[model samples]
Target: MIDYRKATVPVWTLATGDVRVPALAGDGPMTAERLAELRSVLAALADEPIATLEVHPLPEKLDSGRGIPLDAASPLAQHLSQLITQSARSSSTAAKATAAGEGLYRMVVPAKVAAQLGQGIVRPMAAKGAAGGIRGAFVNSTTGRIAAGATFVPAGQAAAAGAVGGAGATAGVAVGGSAALTVAAPLVLMAIAVGMSAHADSKRQQAIEHITELLEQLHEQKLEDEHSELDGCRDAIDKATAILLDQGKLGVSLGLDSAVHAINTALGAADRRLARWQSALDKLPDGEAVEIGTLTKSFPGVDDHGGTFRTHLELAALAIALKRRVNVLQAVEHAQSDPGNLFESFVRALKRDQQRLDELESSIAGVLERLSALELARPNGLRPVFTTGEVDRLMSAAHRIRKLGDGVSANSRTTDLAIEIARDKDGSVVVFPALPASA
Candidate 1:
């Protein structure tokens, strides 16, 4: 198991002579007020890409030298095709050419059910798909891949000339488009930076940026730890799709009296995540352009450069202490959209995009896991203080979409998906025997 608990988010400073030094949170764990300040930042992170001030982690390359850069056009082509298919669905020539893989795909439900769902009236656990609303938007209408994301460094260890952190560093491990930085004697470096930031000269935005950076850092760290779990998830999706396709090849009854748009639309997106995850896993061998595991956490204590700076920063202590002062921000995200129809809202917004929600869900779970680790490893320990209720609100908000709870309720959506194709004539669902274990 990857030890997600071992790493921390890197904090840095803009040092003298235009150079960068790893920074520590000068303030203590975020207070409720400070946490409140993160409302907008959290919302932005959930929806947008990292706000990197500069090109910090300089891109590296392939050892074989016959590599396709991940950010290049080749990777994007798959995504482009998905978009074109949607608009051209009405043309039967296009539909006939590719019954399974091409044209506008949809999930056909009864008009009554569609109306009920459109009215925010889904059955229990239907909320699982709702979380996919914003995340779904991140999908490439063409490729259906997720563009979800994550950062670090240490002391004494020197860094690359243009590394994303201060001077001392180690080679970064890339995960998708993002990367991580490592450094020497983290304790010493963090202490020096934290106190320096407290001198009453820092702007509020800097603090906000600090938390945003931590969120990104946490995201990358999770990818490092859960790569295998993610890969397995992707593989499962592929197997399921294969089965569905195998059945499709035998020409099961297809002409149902239903709204073609709804059925195809949902089906088109149902397994998009499968493709998205596969695409990301495919890049694992090429950990360049981005790095992972470089985020170095700090405290008010000691490290390599010298004795502990002003204080001891650790699981017991922290950077900003968020107090949930910005609890309202999370609501801002949902409120800005449809008032009641969360599921319908998500489907409409995401119909054109590729897969991305799973990544975002992973990110929130990663942070929560880290926090839980801290609580477990050292009860009453001084962990990074989120004074604001950002984490709290964030946790609550994340949970809203991240899960629908344990057992059958959580799996109802998946069950419904299976029933979509395999229901029996008696009106009750049928259970197909498992495909060969080798499959």
Candidate 2:
């Protein structure tokens, strides 16, 4: 079993001049295979004297290589030195052979001396030689690659000038010229390219950062808005609740139990609406884009905001039923107190009205139960059931019940007054047999 927690990797920096490339960090100890992979990457670069800036053993906890400076003694430094040296030798020889003008002369340089010059600076000189002309090339002892482009005079010319001093002096001048070109011309071009690349990379990173910040800000603003909306909704619900409570208290004061119950039913309906609102808001994602259509299409629409809305409507219908029932109860109470023929006729009408009210209540209850079940399966908002015509019909029924109750009350009052008048008139009449008991 690999203990992933215990394993650690080091970060390495590959730098060329002032522009530092991104550092690489990965797991596990350094190996020859990994070093070869890094070499392959470096080899692809056309320029030379490319320095592996430094390699550092990163702290175990920090994954990011940012801000952590490279260390000199790391394994990456050794691997880079080896690769650069090998590259410089190969490139330098190629540069010299290719630039060997009209005629070629066998040029020999001691391997030990070449190696002593170091890899870092030499590799670039060899590359320069290859870029400039086929000639004996200069090499950096630090990084063993041909200079980016060498400025050496032709090897054929240098061979001819051997008479002027010696072979050594002529070769030295040629090498010096190559080194100058490597340092001066090619280095400048490489610097410019690196700078442009770095600038472009920096801009890309900035754009990404800006986008991330904007998204975060939008999310926070949305949350604040939702909270404010929820508070406002709660206040509306509380106000409606207070109105229902006040109505109930008024009914109680007037000894109207039926009215009180109707008001209470209305309050319950309001409570259900409040719950539906809460659930709707809860089911929504925190952001602005709440995909309501997508939600409805999935899962047969049984367990969504739609069902909650239907539940609210069902509760409201219950209040309407209670209101109808209250009207019928008031009419029955009035009819029982009457005694005249007109009152009896009104009572019969009221009985028929009470039956109609009962049917309406039962119908409303059935609708509510169906709606509740639908909502439980998939909560949805209620479709409006009462159009203007439906509302007018309900009102008309209520009006008829009220008119019958009023007629019964009026007839009962008239009958009582007539009976009282008759008794008074009879008493006022003269009596011939007064005092018969005394005789």
Candidate 3:
């Protein structure tokens, strides 16, 4: 069994010249055959003629890879095409085609589920038609081939590079047929650039971009990391597509096993730090005074300032944050799944983790701010040094919790396959498409 906790697979884009690198996903290990299936889907991506910035179905190979059926007539395709057309008509064209990055990504499939499906099912599940909101837009489409995205470069950089030169020139010519058009050209270009930048920086795209970068770096430091050869890199050009698309069982659980391991490791560190911190506090004066002949002397103690109390509070907060992550994971694990609503369960799991991380992040930020506000007393001074190495470790622990928690949440959102949640009159949860949205 390939340890999913340590398994790394290749994901890349034509924009990166098809230079595939091992991307990390920590759900659990998979059979060697499953790994091969994932590779096949990635291999199919090289056939894309343009940079694909949205989720797309893995194309079935035809005629020895020289031909691919568009499948545009599929209901999934029609729905996606409509959404894309609407988005384009309502948004700026310049920002629509920017390259964020693209590559292979794993879906959150439980081992038992995989075992039941056996081999050859992976491609179908990955290629299965599904739909939901993506990057703040509605989408209904088939996905699971490869996680791909492309967003614009920074507007300023794009403008400087004259990336949209052709379109800009055409617009400029249509506006003024006179020589003064030259003078107005720069203003027109600048305006277009600003508009592109504004739309490209929308929260939807930013969130997606953030998730993409996180996945990119997830396995970068692993010793077994590998990348495709330069000769294998495919040519790419800017192509503006839809902002919304779907991936498979996408959520915090997508990297559940890896995240659990990370949280456990950090939890252990937090415990050790707390114990050491308490030990250091004990060595400090506890209001006792030493008598020297006719004089009474007492060393500076924790009672002299509020920093020690705050440090302790911060440690407790760190512990709480780590525990909260574990709790969320448990909640996901316990969520009922019996094949009927298994997919919906995954969506709910992602949403639950996302919501909890929001609150946990606020708590973590408060702890970090409090830690930063304290001024450590001189080590050689009489003041009790509550700032021990453990305090530093506590701060680091808090950061790790925040980073991992936030990344998991973002990953869930970015790769989420579908999000269909509603409440019936009785407050019973209802998932859409599979059931009526008003149910």
Roughly what TM-score does model 1 have, to 2 decimal places? 0.16
| Candidate 1 regions with alpha-carbon error over 4 angstroms | 1-108, 111-216, 219-223, 248-439
Q: Judge candidate 2 against the unseen true structure and give its global Cα lDDT, from 0 to 1.
A: 0.26
lDDT of 2 by residue, 226-289 (tens): 2233223322222322222112112333434534444454545455544554455456555443
Best by TM-score: 3
User: How would you encode candidate 3's per-residue C-alpha lDDT over 339-391 as one tens digit per residue?
Assistant: 22322343344345434334443444443443333333322447665467645
lDDT of 2 at 125: 12
Off by over 4 Å in 3: 1-79, 85-264, 267-347, 354-360, 378-439
Candidate with the larger TM-score of 1 and 3? 3
Error of 2 at 223 (Å): 24
Q: Write the number of the candidate with greater lDDT, choosing between 1 and 3.
A: 3
TM-score for each model: 0.16, 0.17, 0.22
**Residue 106 displacement in candidate 2 (angstroms):** 99
Q: How many backbone clashes does candidate 1 have?
A: 88
Q: Write the per-residue lDDT of candidate 1 for residues 1-439, one digit (tens) a residue.
A: 1121232212211111121222222323233223223322322332211111010111122121111111112111122122213312433333332333411111112222222212111222111344432111112333333221211121111121322122122212212211111111111111111111111012112333333444343444432332222222222222322322122221123322122232233233323433443344344444332111111122111111111211111100111111010111111222224334322333344222212322333332343233222211111226766545645544443343222122112221311110011111121211111111001
